[model samples]
Target: MKIKDRVIELLSDKYCGLLPIKSIHEEDTIIDIGFDSLRFMEFVVLIEEEYHIEFPDDLLDIQSTTTVREVIERLEKEV
Candidate 1:
């Protein structure tokens, strides 16, 4: 699947439908979807494992400001 689709799928799985998938916008921040630090870490791990690519540590630092579109773009470059 495409990176955006996979990202959305992962987000949906993690959030358990708390936010409708159709309502997710590219500009939404991770925290906007209720992703606390721990949950964000877990999601990052899933993404790394799924794509076999490790994101830089800096990503964790800036995760609060990171958007869905940014994540998908980064994953596209890595994968």
Candidate 2:
């Protein structure tokens, strides 16, 4: 699957079950989806496992505020 589609699937399964995938926009940040610090970390780890890549230290700190578009861009690079 495309990175964006996988992301939406992950988010839907792991966090926002009630929110439809169609409602999630690339411009939406993790926090915009109601992810707190704990959920954010869980998601980061999930993505890392899915892609077999550890996120860089710099990216970890700002991830909660990073938009889905930016996340997809970074994930594409990592993968």
Candidate 3:
């Protein structure tokens, strides 16, 4: 699946549909989409497992304001 689709799926599952995936925009930050620190960390873990890549430690410093598009861009670079 495309990275964006997979991200939506993972988040939708994790949040139990609390997140309205269809309403999310590429530029929207995780916090803007209702993800707190714990939820974001869980999402990161899912991304790591799905891509079979360990994110750099510096990634943990990513701001909550980081956009979905930015995250996808970073993941694509890793791939």
Q: Could you say which candidate leads in lDDT?
A: 1
lDDT (10s digit) by residue, model 2, range 1-79: 9988998777664454335687778898867866666666777788878888887666675555688788778778778
Candidate 3 lDDT tens digits, 1-79: 8877776777664453246677777888867877777767877787787789997565666586788788777777886
Candidate 2's TM-score reads 0.78
Give the TM-score comparing model 3 with the true structure, all chains together: 0.79
Badly placed stretches (over 4 Å) of model 2 are 13-18, 63-65
Worst 10 residues of 1 by lDDT: 11-20
Clashes of each: 0, 0, 0
Q: Which candidate leads in TM-score?
A: 1
Q: In candidate 1, which residue ranges exceed 4 Å CA deviation? A: 14-18
Candidate 1 clash total?
Answer: 0
